[model samples]
Target: MPVVWSAVGAVVFPNVGGWLGGLITVRNIKPWYESLVLPKWRPPNSAFGPVWTVLYSSMGYASYLVWRDGGGFDGPARLPLILYGTQLILNWAWTPIFFGAHNLALSLADIGLLWINVAACGYSFYHINHTAGLIMLPYLAWLTLASALNYCVYRDNSTKIKEVKKDE
Candidate 1:
């Protein structure tokens, strides 16, 4: 019921899943990740941390806005919150699938679903609070880049049999 409980506690802490997941999954993935035939425009590895930090914080705050405006779980915010949580889970799953398990195809599937969930979540949030929905746009933008990168990596790096040469 206190402001601190509502503000500090609510606004400041939603990324533990991401931080911990990255820590565990990324611990030994550098070499293999470095070996991938990435697109010419792929962001430097350092970019991801700062980008995700901002995005996570943005979405976290956005969720709080929706919760405050829509009266949390008992009201209109319920489905939006569930969509937000679902996207969070999908977002958290990507690194483990890509870096830990080395499964590019599956990673693409996960990210694709993540993108859809985020869009749906944003739409739902918009109906409740404009700021909350607007806040999700950057995350969607970043996901756009990430999804394209994932698709390219999977296409270029996955194994394939060379097509037989045809006689002229």
Candidate 2:
């Protein structure tokens, strides 16, 4: 198959999840997400769309590099690609878990797993293609911030906190 097909396939696949997440996000961002006691460090709502656009596109290209140079799923890239997919699924699940279901605890757990999986994915990619590995670094960094945010959100909104506030 042509490289374009592979590249496009890789690129579009992740965005499909992003698009789906957006659908879930749109319905819940107002009244639901807005009502949460988010941390001060949370980025402006406007920042997310652009940031994720870059991250998703970059990660998608990184996957393409691994797929092409590592010889697709039939070869060395198999495990790495699987790691990538696992992380992607975790990534995709975050929106529904947090925004759609308004379950901060489960979202935290999902992103926590995602954080670990992404590190492993990046490591596996590095072994196959250095650039692919390098490309995933930003994603890992973003997850660091995201994981912290998830923890904060979960903590701030925990039942314990709610009970404490009620007692006050």
Candidate 3:
């Protein structure tokens, strides 16, 4: 059935983003990330995986609800789905920009864009399916926290970049 595929697709898409982020993150956890000056409020590294797993799953399910209710991805139905996909791509890009490239400032900017996209997506989803819109709330909350963390990291670690450049 089309509904079934949409459901499966909703979950699969965000998980793929999560998977790509994890791959970039794993290699950088030591030396690069561990050495950074983090905020006192930062959650333990162990907390990230489980939290992200739940968030990604919920995001997928929410998207599925919108798709199923909107009568497939055509006309007005396409906008929310497009916003959803855009946010997912932004989500996937954050880890690589932060961890892989170690550009905290750029990562902060990327997260800012991601936060906007998420809010827009949530609004679009809300227009289609109220529950789907509600599902995005947690993700928006998490992004708020993440944006704060990214800002903190960028502020605290800026000197490290300067130091690296000085040595070069």
Candidate 4:
């Protein structure tokens, strides 16, 4: 039972990070998001729930595998796992900036960093466990698409924060 609980925690931790990010934006974001000119290829709003659900699951499982293989909190394998935590934190920051605060430019910047950290995590995980890194490839691909989407939204929507402040 204890091992099962541990596995459950491993699988849920990453999704919890994402959920926390969404919770931060739960109220203030809709109007700004609805105003954007998204690409024709963008999925319907409904698609995001399911897509993120699966993606988060994959992320959680990969994280679990890394932790299981890499040893406990203070093990020699801690380096890759530490990068994993960093990437997750960056990932968690994107939604609130993009949705809650309606800062598309900031969101773009955050996503850009998210992309880099994810790649770094992937590479580090590859050295730790090849399959664990492979599991994150889809996540990297999705973030690539999301970063492009974020950039497009920023270009089509918000003025530079500096410009807005000057006008104010």
Model 4 lDDT tens row, 1-168: 876777788788778876776666556447545656777777677667667777888877777777778785677458878888888888888887778777777888888988998898888777767898998999999998888888877886666544666887
**Model 3, poorest ten-residue lDDT window?**
68-77
Writing each residue's lDDT as its tens digit, candidate 2 over 1-168 gives 688997988877898899889989988888767777889988888887778888998899999999889888899999999999999999999999988877778898999899999999999999999999999999999889989988987887787546756897
Q: How well is each residue in 1-168 modelled by candidate 1, as lDDT tens digits?
A: 674477555555667766877685567456777777789999987788778888888898889888889989999999999998899899988888888877888999999999999999999999999999999999999999999999999998876211212221
Residue 140 of model 4, lDDT score: 94
What TM-score quantifies how close candidate 3 is to the native fold?
A: 0.95
Question: How far does residue 24 in candidate 4 sit from its true spot (Å)?
Answer: 4.6
- lDDT, model 2, position 108: 88
Cα lDDT of candidate 2 equals: 0.89
Give each prediction's root-mean-square deviation over alpha carbons. 5.2, 2.9, 1.2, 2.3
Best by lDDT: 3
| Worst ten in a row by lDDT for model 1 | 159-168
Instruction: Write the residue-wise lDDT of candidate 3 on 1-168 in tens digits.
Output: 876887887787788888888988999999889898999899999989888998999999998898878875874659999999899888999999999999999999999999999999999999999999999999999999999999999999999988987998
Evaluate residue 22 in candidate 1 and report its C-alpha lDDT on the 0 to 100 scale.
65
Residue 96, model 2: lDDT of: 91
Q: Highest TM-score among the candidates is held by which one? A: 3
The per-model lDDT (C-alpha) reads: 0.85, 0.89, 0.91, 0.77
